[model samples]
Target: MSVTPHVVPGQYREVSDANGRVYRVGETDRSLLGRPRAWMVWLPWIAMMGVSVYEYGYSSAEAVLEHAHGWTLTETFWIASIWAVFQAGVAFPAGRLRETGVLPARTAMLAGAVFSGLGFLALSHLSNPYVVIAGYSVLGGTGAGLVYATCINMVGKWYPDNKGARTGFVNGGFAYGTLPLIFVFNYWFHPSNYKMVLDLIALGMVLVVAFCGMFFRDPPKSWWPHDVDPLNRGVSEDARRVAKRLAKNPPAKGQFTPMEAIRTGQLPLMWFALVCIGGVSLFGINFQVPFAKSLGFGPLVAASSAGVLAVVNGVGRAIVGWLSDYLGRRQTLGLVLVVAGLAQFGVLWSGQAHNEPLFLIFAFLNGFGGGAFYPLFAALTPDYFGENNNAQNYGLVYSAKLVGGVGGGGVAAGVVAAWGYAGAYYLAGGIAFLSALITVFLRQPGAPRRSGDGSPVAEVGGRTPSPAEATT
Candidate 1:
């Protein structure tokens, strides 16, 4: 039996497999974009780094922000909470617009650049919390979200064959990139100089994000690497390596539309897991510094803890991403979540015990476990669904962070005030454990499952599973 591919005129040729999953093949990145696709990874990475300060560095600057704005501690934390809400809230809509062709990648980046700058400016100038929320949290968060969502999806689109490592590398920039600024905000930032420092940050963000986004381009729909055959095995060494990876991390049975993905029930589970883990991660991001400081740790220990976390948070993503390629995404994700849960308890004990060295050690572990889950989920979405509609699918999944940001940031502030740091930390640790439990039920949408006897059973035999079949 021969398979006929439908050619899309000038773009690429599309071939459908037995399950009707389409692959647009024949065009190379060089032909379509004039440069290698590696740029996709690097450019998005730089852009992601530009916005890293929003959530990661905010903790370092919290004292200065509170003093400069004449706001209470609770007010300052809420700004970050609100910012998280908008930053995550925008992902789905931005992705929908991008997928629908209403928003071009270049335009989204440019807008993100301007809005990011405005967010900083709002932080620099606005004393009123509400106004800052309107200007910085709403506008600025949306900009950051656009850039974040766009950069992540861009890499996923460009590298369908090996998404785990590439996505993790790019995602890492969003964490570790704030390392230098973390120190600066802690030491050099004062109320008098805060305005200037924040202004400078805004300018730098605009330049970096705008410069990187100009070259942003999306690969054609269903695009697969030209050298590799997607549907069948090829003889080349590279193809053989890819084939092995595919066997372990099998592709979805077919391209699932967002609705279809939701119907499979896996998306909701992924969403729930994200909400849980994301809240814990965000709680750490927003409160780790304050927690350390409250225990009488010096400025250096506090800043250093954050710096270490940021650095490890980033590096760990790349390491685990590479590991997932060999170990499998779901298994790796579960392990990461468990470590995160345990690390939270470590952080609590170290903080309460006033053990500086131990605190940093737990911070290191927490950073490694905290941020790595993001890329795993990012890669998992496409692995479970298909890449054709990945931007939207991932947008839907990533939006879970909206709830996470609020719970971890603002609601967390209330928790800290009411229950104290120990109580909040305990709650966060419990949430992370719950997320790990949820990961157990996450099977690929239409893929095989192990039977009670440890033999493989075809769940749907490479066909889309019904909602009832998926839940079981």
Candidate 2:
């Protein structure tokens, strides 16, 4: 529980391996940040929740937004779809900027706060769809992207030794954070009062992001926790727990540059899987409420379905993330995809049958399956590729969401118009199943290949390599 300052300021007893990857060891979180590393987790979690309303709660206000702006249903949905596009599209650029020192975390957060606030202002006052798209979709999505990328990175960087649960906890905040707003948009918001409410929400988002970001700081590159041995499996109790994790979900074989990661063929697979799963997740978020309403559900049922989705979506991330620690990332991910795929069909059948209780039950399963994959991919990127270039590496992987946003939102709406909800739900469910299949092919890049004798055959070195040494 107590950490003695072992490394002097600005210096570390660096450790290196055959791959030239360096770890700046011997610094405790308290020594570097003047607080426990847990602060990093909480701050990012709160900030993630602050911007969550942009995605998770936006659906509830669609009808009001359409009436106030004199837009059609499709137009309002496009706003959300476009918002998702920019929101996800900005991750790669933002990650590049953050990792290269071109934009510090604090500065990124401040800029996000300003832009996010303006995005709502644009939505509040602008009636023209194009202008609103530029302001709300582009600016607002970018703001959310910056915060989202930074928060996830912060958690991963601080807790590399055990990031699954921590990353999941922070990532979950992005979904459920919109719970209160979902109800407000459904019950209290109308065209007459929408502007005032949105303006207030914008201001609150700005304050939360800016305040939490003020304390944001990245640890020195390749920083490892002082108590955990980055190489040897220590005999200490903490080290033993870490060893167990390593056995299940080992760290990267070596630090991989973005291009290197791409060359390994694993990065592309990860991207494709994210695209598939993310589209399914976004489809649920955008359509669940509308689908309920279309099925002749009451106002409360419609809103409650969305609220339930948001809550389960968020909480499931944390639960599955923690579970992944012991269960192995690949196995847990496969399970999540399978469960989500089945739930999609369940939702469709229940809705068609007009079974409200059954519908709600499937909605719970749908919500759980919807948001859990995000944290897994977030953690898996660094798990497969070392954390040094993780911001940019994960950026590349997370960018799939841009395409997913379009597919799940605008493209999905078109599918609905053609085939109705039945066809669209079927497509989304199929995509989840495909992603689950992809999970079967995922293996740690550069890890030793088994020989005919069933012994580890060296792939990169003359002997069986440690998990972190296999990639190079």
Q: Supply candidate 2's per-residue lDDT for 95.
A: 87
Residue 34 of model 2, lDDT score: 94
Task: Report clash pairs, candidate 1.
Answer: none
Residues 1-472, model 1: lDDT tens digits = 1122332334445555555466766677787788999999999999999999997999999998988789998899889989988998888888888988999899999999999999999999999999999988999999999999999999999999899999999999999999999999989999889999999999999999999999999987777877767765577687688888887787777777788899999999999999999999999999999999999999999999999999999999999988898889999999999999999999999888889999999999999989999999999999999887888999999999999999999999999999999999999999999999999999987732323642212223234445554322
TM-score of each: 0.92, 0.93
TM-score of 1: 0.92
lDDT of model 1, residue 59: 94
RMSD of each: 6.9, 5.8
Q: Which residue runs of candidate 2 sit more than 4 Å off their true CA positions?
A: 1-11, 17-20, 447-472
